[model samples]
Target: MTGDTQSWRRAAPASPVTLDDVARRAGVSLATASRALGEHPHVAAATRARVREAAEALDYVASPEAARLAGGPTGRVAVLVPHPSRWFFGELIEGLEAALRAADLDLVLFRVGGPEERAAFFDRLPARRKVDAVVVLAVAVDDAEHARLASLGVDVVVAGGRVAPYPSVGIDDHGAGRQAMDHLLHLGHRRIGLIAVDDDARASAWRTALADAGIEPEDELATTVAWGGEGGAEGMARLLGLRTPPTAVFAHDDETALGAIRTLRRAGLRVPEDLSVIGVDDHPLAALTDLTTVAQPVREQGRRAGELVAAALRGDLQEPLAEVLPTRLVLRGTTSPPGAPR
Candidate 1:
C-alpha cells in the first residue's frame, strides 16, 4: 500500500493470464473453460459465452499444446486402408499425404483388410483418443462399424468409394461401369459377359445396360470372383466354358482384365481377335499391356477427401460433402469389334 511499493509493483511486467484465471472469472470448472475455448460441442451456449467473455477480459491466449491436452485437435488423421500393398491404395495414400502435409497434419495408416481385422480396429479406435479425424480408403463400413466410428466424436471421410452418413469423394461406380459396358455394346457385341469382384454398382450397370440394349442378362455370363488377376482368370474360365460364350467380357478392373487376357492366351484365343475385353481403373499396367479401361481420378479423390477433412476441422465446411469426380473411357488394343480379323 506504500507509494514506493506500489510504484515497484506497477513497473514489474504483469503475469500472463492463464486458463485457470478465466475459469475462476467465469464461475466454471477449469475443464469447462477448456472445453468452451476448444469449441467442444457438448458445452452449453451460455457457458461458452461466459467463458469467452472471461477469456477476453483476462486477455487469455490459449497455447496450442494446452488446447491439445484439453481435448482439442491432435493434428493427426487416421487413414483406414483395406489393401495397403495395392497400387490403387498407394496412389490414394500419396495424394492424401500431400494434402494433409500441406495442412500441417500427420497421416497414420491402419489396415482393416478382413472381417477380424476390421472388427478389432473398430473396437479399439474408440478406446483411444489419438486422431482428430479418420479417412476410410475404399473400405465398406457396416452399420455397426459406422456406429463405432461415430463414437470417436471426430470427422469421418471416405475416399475411393462412397459411404453413407459421412463426407465422401469418389467417382460414380455405376457411371464408370456404364462407360465400360456401353463401349463393348457399341463395338458390335450382343453377348457381353461381366467378371465382377463384387456385386456392386458396376455389376448392376452391366445388367441394366444389357437389359436396356434388349439383350437378356444371363446368370451364366456374369461371374463373381475375388479381386485381382487370379480371380479374373477364374471368372473368364467359367465364362469360356458356358454353352454360348460371350463375344466380349467386362472385367471389374484393369488387373482383372489382364488376367482374363492371360486366360484367353492360354486357351489359344487372341485378345480382341477372338474375344474383346474391357475393364475399369486405368492402372499403370493397363497402358503397358494395352488394356482398355475406364479411367477414374483415383488420386484426386484422396486429395479432395483430405481437403474435406481440413475444412471440417477448421469449422469451415457448411455441410457433409459428397463429391463425385468424373470418369472417362480409355481405348486401347484390348477392345475391338467382336471377332474382327487379327
Candidate 2:
C-alpha cells in the first residue's frame, strides 16, 4: 500500500465518526448540529460554521442512505393548499410545479381548507414520513398547526403569505391594497367603500389610506363576507342598501370586483359612469371584464418559493428569507373620477 493510504488507515477510528461526536465536539445540541449540517435557515451562522469545522476535524462523513432511512430527503415536497380550485392557487401550483420539476423533485398536494380537514391533516402528519419538506400555499398556519409541522423534522416554506420563523415569498398585501384604494382616491372619489373577505392587511390599508386622505372611514362602508364571487355579490348588495351608497368601491380581489359589478348591473347602473370600482390581483378574467386592479405576480411568488425549497434541501440556505415581490396599478375601463362624464 502507498504511504498515505497506510497513514490514513492507522489514523482512522475503529468505528465511523458518529454525528453525536461532531455535535459534542462542536459544543452544540444534536438537533442543532443536524440543522447546521442540513443547512436549515434557523441555525446561527456561527453555530453552523463551528459544526462544519468539527465534522472536518473528526473526518466525519454523513451517509445518504442512512439519512434517508432516518427520515431524510425523499425527493418529494408536500404542498398544503387551502383552495386549490381558485385561480390564485392554480397559478401558484403551476409555477411551483414547474420549478420543482426542474429541480427533479416531486410535489404532493394536500387540500387543507376547512377546520376539520386542517385538523385531520395535522393530526396524521406525524405518521407520514414521505416528504422531505412542506410548502404552505396561501394557508395561514395557526400555533397548533405550526407546532405539528415543527415536530415533523422537515423544512417549511410559505408562498403568497407570511408565516413567522419560516422562509416565504409573496407580495405586500398592504401595498397592493394601497394601490387599489389610492387609485380610487386619485380619481376624486371621497365616498369609497371596501369589500373584504377578512380584516387582513388589505383592510388595514383601506382604513390607513382613508385616514391619510383626511377622511374618516365609516364603519358602514366596510363589509366582510365569506370569499369568492357569491360572498362579494352579497357584500355589494348590503353596501347598496345603505342610506348613501359609495361613489367608488374597493373589492378585495378581481373576482370580488366582478361580483360587485354584477350587483351594479342588476341595479341598472353603468360602471365608471354611475360609480367607479377597483380591486387587487389581476386575475385572468379581470382583463377580459375590464376590471381595474392591483396586479401582483402570483406565479412568480410560487416559483420563488419552489426555489427556496430546493435551496433548503441542498443545504445551501444560510438564513430564513422573506422575499416580497412588487405590485402595480392596472387602470382599466371600470374606474374613473366620481360622476365623470362618460
Candidate 3:
C-alpha cells in the first residue's frame, strides 16, 4: 500500500471500447447506436449525433465483419444482367456503377443468360449474404425462377423488366411500343414490318399495339429475330422477299433499327422515301444514323435503381416503390410520311 498504488495498478490494460459501451453512453439501444454509426437513414439526427459523440469519446471502432454478421448492410450491390457484352446491359451497368461509387458502395457483376446459365444461377443463389441488394437488368425469368430469386431475400430494383414483389424503374413497354408503331402508322404506312427480339416482353406489347391499330402484322411482315445488328439484317432480308413488302418497319431497338437502315441502303432504297423506319431506345448511334426512336432514360434508370437500393440499405424505403419512367418519341431522318421524295 505504501509503494504508490498508482504504479501497482499498471493502468489495468486499457479496454477496447465496444459498440455496447457507445450505446450505454448515448442512452440508446444497441441497434439504434449501430444504425447511427452505419449512417442509416432510420436513426434520428439527434440520436445519430449523440451516438457519434459517444463513439468518439470512447474511441470505438466497428468491425466490418462483425457489423455484417449483426445484420447490417454490407455496402455491396450485385447486378444481374443477361449478357454483359450487349450494349444495353453494358450501358446499364456503367450507370449503376457510377451511382454505387457515389454512395461509397461496391458492385459485383453476374452475367446470367440462356436456360442453362439462368437455371444454375437461380439454383445456387450465390448472392445470399454477399451483397446488400440486387439490381436485375432486362432478363425475364419464368415463375419458378422468380420464386427462386425471391428466396434470396435481397432487396431488388429492376432496370428493364418488371418482376413482382420488387420495385422497378423502367419505361412502360406497352406505351413505348405504341409510340413507335403510331409514328410509323401515322406516317401513312399500313403495311408495316416488325423486327423484334424473339420471346421478349416488348414483342407482346408490339403485338398489342398493332392489334389496337387494326393492323394485323402478317407472317410475311412480322419476323422474330435475335437481338442485334445481324438479326436486323436477316429479318429485313426476309421481309423484303415477301410478296407484299412493307413500306415501313418498326424495330424493337435502335441497334436493330440501324441494321435495318443498312439493309435498306444496300438494296438501293432511300430511308424514309422507299421506306420509313422507327425504333425504341435512343441508342448512342441513333443520332449519327438519324434514327427516329422512342427515347427512354436508360442510364437514369440504372442510376435511380442504384439509389433505391442504397435507400433500402439505409432503411429509408421500407415499402416497395414502383416507378415507370417516361419515354419520348424522337423524329429524325429515318422516318417520314411514306413515299416522300428521296
Q: TM-scores, in order shown? A: 0.81, 0.84, 0.77
Ranking of all candidate structures by their TM-score, best first: 2, 1, 3
lDDT of 1 by residue, 1-342 (tens): 599999998899788888779878987655456667888654567778888999999888898644753596578899999999999999999999999999889999999998888887899988786887899998888898988886675778999988997889999999999999999999989999999999999999999999999999998899999999999999999999998999999999998988999999999998898999999999999999999999998889889999887766654443566899999999999889987998
Residue 342 deviation, candidate 2, in Å?
A: 2.2
Per candidate, the number of residue pairs that clash is: 0, 0, 0
lDDT of each: 0.87, 0.86, 0.78
Stretches of model 1 off by over 4 angstroms after superposition: 1-36, 39-70
Q: List model 3 lDDT by residue over 1-342, tens digit each.
A: 755787768757687788778878987545456667877654557777888999999888887643643465567777888889877888788888888898888998877877777776777764456666678898766788777655554567788767766778887887888888887778788888889887565677667767778877576678988888888988898888988788999898998888888888899989888988888998989988888999998888888888877665554554666888899999888888878986
Top-down lDDT ranking: 1, 2, 3
Tell me which of candidates 1 and 3 scores higher on TM-score.
1
Cα TM-score of candidate 3: 0.77
lDDT of 3 at 251: 91
Highest-lDDT candidate:
1
Candidate 3 regions exceeding 4 Å error are: 1-72, 125-128, 199-201
When 1 and 2 are scored with lDDT, the better candidate is 1
